[model samples]
Target: MPDLRFQSQPPAHTEIPRPKRAEGQWSLGYTEPLNKNEQSKKDDDALNVRDRILYTYSKRGFASIDPADLRGRFRWMGLYTQRAPGFDGGKTAMLEEEELDDEYFMLRVRSDGRLLSHEAVRALGTIGVDFARDTADVTDRENIQYHWIRIEDVPEIWERLDAAGLSSLEACGDSPRPFLGSPVAGVAKDEIIDGTPALEEIFDRFIGDPAFSNFPRKFKTALTGHPSHDVSPETNDVSFVGTVHPEHGPGFDCWVGGGLSTNPRLAEKMGVWIPLDEVADVWSAVASVFRDYGYRRLRSRARLKFLVADWGIEKFREVVEKEYLGRELVSCDSPPSPTGHRDHIGVHEQKDGKFYVGVAPVAGRVSGSLLVELADTIEEYGVAGARLTPYQKIVLVGVDADRVEDLVTRLDEIGLSARPSQWRRNTMACTGIEFCKLAIVDTKERARDLVTELEKRFPDLDTPITVNVNGCPNACARTQIADIGLKGQLVMHEGEQVEGFQVHLGGATGLQANFGRKLRAHKVTSAGLDDYITAVVGNYLVDRQDAESFATWVARAEEELLRGEKALTPS
Candidate 1:
């Protein structure tokens, strides 16, 4: 018979201490593993079999608890709230203190029209939850997050979130990430077709698919009808972009390979075009190829691009066709002429007499109070709803035309603005070292600081310059796709090395998806980094052609020349 007795104490030698690093070296620490006896005690203490599995799995670093166990763990607690109207009756809940042991508690929100309320935010905050500061982030899709949740709080938290219309699906790990579509899909003036319905359809198909849930690597997919490339379909692993074919019909231009990390690469176009009606089939086929052929053993090299690289593009197409259609697949017709970029900022006249006001929320940081204020304002104005932008901004859609000025004033009072100047329109950054363990610097704060200084120095700079800053090489800021990219690094300062950055230039999105080139490395000291950016922008503004943009100018400059110019500029 197997040993059944549980030990009262954890086994000796379970915890390991960190090795001493030399004074100048950077060190990252790892948690020590628990002994078998301690693990048994933990399992015995678990509230249920599902809780036991979660406790054990978390100890093993996999976080894999069976869905049945997940449901069982909360069933008796009344954590699963009723589904929001028009939703798929998915379980939604808030974390109780005991249930939140991981760095973050995963909550599923009602994807159907429900948005989180201000009261919900405050309730979480009053209970010592700090989503905004504790790496709370919004996914490429519209879901908001609150990480660093303690295990014990999981059940109660789930209950609260359920009451607030949030649920828990496969929000993390190898599962397909939430399907992204144009935030303004239904409201955009130039939309050929709203991609939301299709996005929802694909989302419903894959969210709990066993095959997708346990895939080798994370998969991200996006859809966009807006010509502005606001959803940035090119940067996702698989993308279906809304476009028109000259002779065929309305459809999506399929693309693959775009990702951001240590080695950022823009996705390459896979097929010429895919008709709207066949998008699901095309997506399924492409996913099947990735599922079968993608690298599974190596975590770092598991993205679709690596597969595309190992097997040449033609070979990849061959496999996709064979697996998807079970026969030869013919290329579709070419896409139509491209339309100019459009961002739904300022007051735009909707097809209806109503207007949509775009509000820029710097760094996407919104408190519970702010969220409540915005919702109340929306209610008061009798607007349709709010739309989140890829650029960490928000749009209040369908506001009454007569109340536009009043609405704008109210938004400004709450620190959200509809005004878009050259600098504020497109600045983006990642969470940096302040919260993300992998980050090397404080990117979001630094980005805002950098932009504020640049505006002061070059008051008349009218060009739209996108600056992206990632805390580390992971490139969460999409640094590789910006006009100016800054990745965190360590630089020697006063005999001791501190956090700094390696700067890159020239990257741009949309039709001109080019990787930014490394321009200079600068120490992020209080006295110097700002001056470097000012000088670089000033040089580009003064030297480039009349119509040439900042990116184009940076692309043309020699690396050495750019570095020297930046170094010479004083703070």
Candidate 2:
């Protein structure tokens, strides 16, 4: 295959139109974009910088990099200049990208399906040790992300990745991101069908293919053949959830237009059944619809969910079939609700008579040394492989049943606990003010501290509660879908401004997916966050129905209790 620079343009689509209705949110409101938004730069094909990075700019260092590529086009290659050290949280919105750009960068290596061979893991870890300042973290997208990466070392990092059969291509920006796949796809006993082959086909056909490279905004996909719904398909741009039709045996139920962020929406079932063999084509058709008709005038409203919301599921289905696929789909019922074990934590029996052990680190903050140690330990246990989950956990696969106990014990020693406390297992957070330029407040460290505090405070609490914290409005940690979600921002504290958070109560996904409710005009200083959560959760512990979920109680609780009025002074 020829490189994209030499290849011809992809097939043309109908021009993007400004929505005549209620779609003109901030992104689309402008006629001729004043600041020359990303759309204009993308028009020249963002993927046209292969030689520039490898041949010119990289050799000359970051100083020689093109301004356009440095800030915008670099995302196509999954690189972002991390926030410079010493930039406080209060300076978040005040500084522009250039002013905040650190000499080092953050690289997100796509983990399509989270499959990691021992050799791949070791190579990645070695790169972290050699060049990335020994910094590596597992992201909720199942990616191995690195911080403090110098621009000069990027080519060397790519070389190591290639040797390990990996690439960061199309991992970020306005392209299809790494798709979420069930970690136990083939191993799970109750899996409908293995979605592995389908995922491989989709990646080979579309990833880095300039034809599908450009879109209105980033597109996300998730597919799972397991009943557990471990892939969290309900919150993706497009998802193929495992289901067995009464007559068709096992296949997939397609859902479209799901996404989280400022405007959260659950994906609606497309009322179609897709077979494994044809899934790649169906996926392409759905993506094509987004390319041709998705709103591009506004970056904020450009996500596929917005288009699906405006068109309605029926109309969206009509366009997908008539305009893109050219074939009608087999109508089928929606898949059943996911099992309670979406996280896939702890040891579970696989169909192969072996077992897979799932474990989590504190808020996904594993270092490169930890990665190497994990890979070495899995090798010692004779485990065939490992896979990452959207919940920011890792599962070692194909371990003998007899080795389960020993392996779990070893994992515990390495700080990856197979049997973690509720707080340790349930909490997830995004890279916040520590590294990300767009973040308003700290998240990773804050979440880690919160988990420890809560575990100590509620050692005997039985019911499970999810806590998701996001740095900004982007909701990278899926804040809107957690039982207790904290969105970071600047809030007035004691007549002065400081880092704080706005709370979202009772958010949940799966059978009854809905964004959490908010206490209007309520924000809590970061310092008081622990007290606020402890008090509110304590209130729930004292008064509740039998086996009542946090979401259920939150739905019925009074505003006073949810706000922790007695314990907190609201800002």
Candidate 3:
């Protein structure tokens, strides 16, 4: 594989047709002239990247690939050049931006709706081992990431995945990524609706379709019929949460414009009930609205959430109904607030009399060979299916009562613990400096260490806490909503640079969903992270009144006490 140096060119600029403004109401009307950057982003065809990768780069190998294609175009085909393994002290600060892309690539495979069959899973595992050097990680978005890939082998990998009914198209880039749905969609006993049919409809109709290949930026969608808010509706661009109307037995309530990054905002409800049949249409309309009317000037503010924030849910709903749906949506009752942990960890009975065993992989990191082992186990059971959860977990569905014990024992041996401890189950970590070019510090390893230390120090901790560690402010691990969110950065310790994290306290979801507030002047070096968190949790355990949640305690605790004394000088 040659190291190709493709010249970087400014993206093309073009004009989009303007929409007619509705009188006395706000709409996504293009009232302002487009800037050069905005024009470049919109005028540039995202679909062109695909042909270029397929014909030019694939034929000429890695050396002929252009830099522009490396960053912008390669993503259309779900290929990202990963950082070389040995670089340390965070890629962002350690090396020049252009030097970040080594010979290897991280291939993101779209597990649309988080649905995977036995054959597909097996095929993915094989690809990971054969092509990716056994490097694989399950992302928070329910996508499978494979590293150590080269340009020459990309076509063969695609063929293998396609043969198993999987795809990597539109998994990244400006188009829609993997669609999130309930891991227990069809089998959950407490579900209001199955939601699989709707998910399949949207996937078949829109995914990989050229009409939706281009957008201002990446778009995220989630659909779930579960009552526990298992799919995380409020944090997605478009979400359809299950609800039951008094007149209509069951349907979905719509939400729009939820996202997290440097600026975080929860999704706003549309107060409209969409029947099962209309879900796909509603989804398409929302994506079309984002593509046509979403802001294109600033890439930073181009997500659908920004548009929703400016328009307000009411006005946004009106635009969708009038311009897209051409019919008014029925108003319906809202669903109940989510209760308890929705990660679906541990074993539980499904509606089908069989069982589903949810297992947590530590920090969502698993080897390719381990995936193969799990796939073999699934085949042995001759079960219905398996799915990945938003919690960085996996659920083996449709296991009979007779096979549950044997499956659990086998899973435990493979490090996929069906009944993991709180540290193992609730802890989540994002790809850090090891593979991510934008990362400021190492996250996966640090998170694993923090979990281990916390478990040892606070063995009797009964209250649940979600510990999310993100390598950057992008919030890939959803640091904003975790009970204790750690955002990675570089810090000076004893006059030398060291890995550190900024602390965010008290973020909770469900009825009282809110982003965690940052703790001022509170930074802890990676070496002392364990001690600092242990002390903080120790304070919470001592002061908390009557089984108060960790987030609740952090909300009312004095800042001085919350920060703890040991954090004053982290060495």
Q: Candidate 1, which segments miss by more than 4 Å at Cα? A: 1-141, 159-168, 327-330, 333-343, 520-527, 558-561, 564-571
Write down the TM-score of every candidate: 0.76, 0.93, 0.91
Off by over 4 Å in 2: 1-35, 38-43, 339-341, 566-571
Q: Residue 14 of model 1: what lDDT?
A: 19
Give the deviation of candidate 3 from the true structure as CA RMSD: 6.6
- Rank by lDDT, highest first: 2, 3, 1
Q: What is candidate 3's lDDT per residue for 1-571, written digit by digit as tens? A: 1111112312213233343532111123543334543343344555577677767788898889877677676787888888766676544775775687788898998776655778878888899899999988888888889999988788889899889888888888888888898999988899999888998899898877767876768989898999998878889999999999888888999989999999999998887788999999899778877876787666777888887877778778876776667677898757877744499888999888999999999999997898898889889887676788888889888899899999999999989999888888899999898888888889988888877878787776676788999988899898989988999988889998898988888887787688887877879888888877787887777778887888888889878767877333332
lDDT of 3: 0.81
Full candidate order by TM-score, most accurate first: 2, 3, 1
What tens digits encode model 2's per-residue C-alpha lDDT throughout 197-307?
Answer: 999999999988877886778999999998878877878999998888889988998999999889888998986788999999889888877765666666788899998
lDDT score for residue 396 of model 2: 87
Model 3 alpha-carbon drift over 4 Å, by segment: 1-44, 85-96, 566-571
lDDT of 1 by residue, 221-285 (tens): 77776666667776788888776666665677777777878767777676556656667666766
Q: By TM-score, how accurate is candidate 1?
A: 0.76
Q: Give the winner by TM-score.
A: 2
